[model samples]
Target: MYIDLAATPDFKRSLFNAIVAPRPIGWISTVSASGRVNLAPFSHFNLVSTAPPVVMFACNAPDDRHEKDTIVNVRETGQFVTNLVTWDLREPMNTSSFNAPYGVDEFELAGLEKAASVKVRPPRVAASPASMECELLQIIDIDPVGPGDTFSNVVLGRVVALHMDDRFVDAGGRFDVVRTRPLTRLGGNQYASTGELVELGRPNPPR
Candidate 1:
């Protein structure tokens, strides 16, 4: 069936999310200027660059009038941590996504412990397999099309420091994705784990 995204009814709910299947969950942690810790998960997240190791996550406001706590904190402090969510940490990751009151510490709300970060003030999830400390590069705001629709803030950050569990690393220095089993997001209330892996090499062009 051919669908015109701009003309489709409830396009975001009907097709956008489902079509963008199996997105990586960036379990982001940040601290407010007043020292309150905030944690949330964003499915609209991915690495956008490699030379300086930049990653981006999109935070959608519930309405045009208000921004999410994570976005507010990131604007105030300019630092955040991206914690890799593994299979074992899925439940807590879900818990942290709740819309708690502003300034509430989600780490405590989720009953998870925090590990001190090296390059950023924001703490990383102690149970996560890997965490990347990042400094804010920029934030781009996407305005809504209609009057009641929500808007999104695209945040880009450069990785300043990385923390990884040595157990997940191979002798060849390759990080084992299959072993980590990261939690990924699918449509609706569905979720997936990276337990299976496929290997393919780049094809060479004929000279």
Candidate 2:
């Protein structure tokens, strides 16, 4: 059945998350200018460019006039880190998703250890398999829905540095993603983990 998104109600809008199954979670960590730390998860995130290594995540404002602490921190310091979420860190990652008040430290709230970042002010999750330090590029605002004043902000950032666990590196220097078993979000309240391995080669026509 074809569904008209413009006609759909706000409650039904979340169905898009189900339609786009198994999205990778961007467990982002940011630090306020005053040194307060914030950690949160966003499934509306992915790598948008590889030439210069950029990633993006969509963050919805808490209300019509104010943004979330993550966005505020990102805007304040112009830096953030994406900590890869894995099956092992699922609990802490979930805990970080809480709507903690501004200036609240989600790292401490979630009981996760923080590691110093090489090129950014924000710290990375020490137990995460990988982390990418990013500098803010821009925040694009989405148009509000009918009668709604609040909108989502798409934050684009250029990856400036990366941290990876030595255990996940291979002899050939390739990072083994399947072995890391990254976690993903599914439909409402559902989550999943990487379970199987598959290899597929792209078609190579005569060059």
Candidate 3:
């Protein structure tokens, strides 16, 4: 059935969330200027550029609170790290998603080891297969739509450094996605892992 997002399709939980399909999870970690650490997971995140290396994630205000710890910490220090969540670390990553109080150490709470980043104050998850150190580039506030009436802020960060697990890297020095087995967020409480692969040859231009 054809439905218009602006008028036809209702802003229901199933419609909006499922429409986005499986989104990559970004396990973000940040540190306050005073050295408080915070970690949280976000599904509304993706790589926006490559040449300059940038990524963007959306952080919404907590359901019953003002804002999330990650957003507050990034705004305070302008730096954060995006840890790639794999299937193995799914449980601990979920633990870090709780609406904990400010200054709460999610790394410690989730029983995850923190590896100090080379250029950022926030530490990366040592168990994660990959992590990107970033500096806050921009923050855009999105107006409320409907249903929950929740607003979100998009944060764009410039990646300054990247760390990857040696096991996931090939001898040629390239990251192997299959070995990484990154976890993805599905609609509702569902989740998925990296599946099979298919490659197609580039079509030649018409003469």
Which parts of model 2 are misplaced by more than 4 Å?
A: 63-65, 147-149
- TM-score for candidate 3, please give it: 0.92
Give the per-residue lDDT of model 3 (tens digit) for 1-207: 766566743545565567796899999999998999999999999999998999999967887777777888889999999999999899999999877778889999999998989998999999998999999999888888755656789999999999988988999998998888889988888898988789799999999
Local error of candidate 1 at 25, Å? 0.4
Candidate 2 structure, TM-score to reference? 0.93
How many clashes would you count in candidate 1?
A: 0
Candidate 2 accuracy as lDDT: 0.90
* Tens digit per residue, CA lDDT, model 1, 1-207: 786656764545636667898899999999999999999999999999999899999977964338999899999999999999998999999999988888789999999999999889999999998999999999999998854457889999999999999999999999889899989998888999975567899989989
Which ten contiguous residues of candidate 1 have the minimum total lDDT? 5-14
lDDT of 2 by residue, 1-207 (tens): 777656754446667789898999999999999999899999999999999999999877875347888888898999999999998889999999888768788889999999999999999999998999999999998877665446789999999998989999999988888889999999999999987678899989989
The global Cα lDDT (0 to 1) of model 3 is 0.89
Rank the models by lDDT, top first.
1, 2, 3
Candidate 2 lDDT at 199 equals 86
Which candidate achieves the best lDDT against the true structure?
1
Residue-level error in angstroms, candidate 2, position 12: 1.2
For model 2, state the Cα shift of residue 61 in Å: 1.4
